[model samples]
Target chain A: MIPVDIPLWADLLASLLMITGGALTLIGSLGLLRLPDLFARIHGPTLNNSLGLGSVLLASILIASIQADRLVFQEVLITLFVVATAPVTAMLLMRAGMYRRRADGGKKKAPQPDEST
Target chain B: MTTLLPFAVSFALIAFALAMIFAGIRLLRGPAAEDRVLALDTLYVNSMITALTLGIQFGDRLYFDIALLIALFGFVGSAAMAKFLLRGEVIEP
Candidate 1:
């Protein structure tokens, strides 16, 4: 067994955070598989990118800081980059989906005919 | 408490691996290009988590940099794919 020198309190806190984050990520991926449509499936990764990733990043930061005996926050850079970019990705994907659907001649119900037509 | 961390790290790694599998399935089974791109996005995110968990296990800071790079490239790839799907070209003239 390899030696782990982390103090008891930090160990407990990090463990709990890791478990929670893991569970959330698992649930999100499950949703991605089980959801019925594209729009619904998009929600799954959204959950993943937000809280799931957030908690895991938090745990990583916590452990690194404790080990270094100082404020080691490089992990925070990943968090910030993810937070800034995830929404943009989602929005682009959503719009692209909508555009493709419209290009396919719209949904089951035809677009209402223009009154002028 | 020391014993608890090993268990937790193992659990997180397993969960992250499962998530990656799920995302892979979605990517393959996608009924649309957008769905595939989204699945790819999720795959990278899961991989990042997996890298982080491994860092915890090995007590190395190097995995943190790996995760950051994955996040950067993954976003660029997914965004480009999505834009291509929307406009039929990744870069509009």
Candidate 2:
């Protein structure tokens, strides 16, 4: 039950923002499936985490503020929460992956330098 | 305020749902545990966005609270899974 009095420019702007965020999110997950390795796959979600989520949150904040007819920016709190937590999760998951690899005696270490003459 | 927001939310719902499917596929076909964990995390975030889009469509503030709760739990679950992977135990102090 969205209000109908919002300007065309505002609506159009929100639409553009939504589409951009959604597309970025889709691409990020797509990268998860298509990427080669675990570490490489980590890069994909970061795109969605930072820019994708940020843009969509911005659009939501804009629309809600308009609808409420006041300075309602509480959605910014989610943005802040996400921005702060995403990297920490990424870092933790990476360390865990490295731990798993090392425990399995997998390829978690650097190769030795060869000095064959 | 017009058809634009509705259209965008609908499009977002479809697109993000499709993204979730891809993530689900990765989760099921994880060649490594970390990949599975990552897919699950992505799924949580995608679903959160889906809820937010629905909230926007209906102009309901309650959905905001739901989205916030999802974000909180998703973070905790992801962090716990990561911790479990880091150490072999979850509750071991």
Candidate 3:
């Protein structure tokens, strides 16, 4: 990797942002795997959607701006997209999981709910 | 600044990669369908962060586009899958 002429403050700030972002991403994924239930495990990645991605994006913004020597706003597009979409995706997935579980956990004694499209 | 910054970036890259691997393991081993989908969602977001870290590491702006694409597609795919799981088919009257 070629070293660029980034100033001290930019480098320090980027480092801090990256380290925190990476750790939060790891913790979120860990929770996704380790949590006992689907609902609980589903929450593990929200950390990524919120702070994890936020920190990383901030780092990218800082470095990119410094390198380009101007205000670059491309990265903010991703931040906005993630903010708008992550919760909706998670909610729909949770509802699906709950629906499936309810229909399945009926012990097979009761008539199964029709799943025909 | 010189010594610590690069080291920190490298460490962050490795950590994000490790996070992706963890999400992959969960995606493969998750018992429930929705759990797998959730893991898959985590996997893509983790990968996106990895892409962003690459931008920070190598000092390139192109990686930003790549990361953005991943985020867009990952969200669409996951949401569609979740909808399918909910209703058997993604589109209905």
Please say which candidate is ahead in lDDT: 2 or 3: 2
C-alpha TM-score for every candidate: 0.91, 0.90, 0.89
lDDT of 3 by residue, B1-93 (tens): 244567777888888888888888888887888888888888888888889888877888889889999999999999999999999998888
What DockQ, on C-alphas, does every prediction get? Answer: 0.75, 0.76, 0.74
Prediction 3 TM-score vs. true:
0.89
The residue pairs found clashing in candidate 1 are none
Model number with the top DockQ: 2
- Please provide, for model 1 over B11-73, each residue's C-alpha lDDT reduced to its tens digit, 9 standing for 90 to 100: 988999999999999999988888899999999999988988888788798899899999999
Evaluate residue A46 in candidate 3 and report its C-alpha lDDT on the 0 to 100 scale.
93
Candidate 3 Cα outliers beyond 4 Å, as residue runs: A1-4, A103-117, B1-3
* Candidate 1: regions farther than 4 A off: A1-3, A103-117
Native contacts matched by each model: 0.79, 0.72, 0.85
The candidates, ranked best first by DockQ, are 2, 1, 3
Instruction: Note the clash tally of each candidate.
Output: 0, 0, 0
Q: Residue-wise lDDT of candidate 2 within B1-93, one digit each (tens)?
A: 236878887888888999999999999998888889899999989988888888788889888888888888999898888888888776786
Task: For candidate 2, write residues A6-115 as lDDT tens digits.
Answer: 88888999899999989999999999988887878999988778888888888888889999888778888888888888888898888777666643335646223242
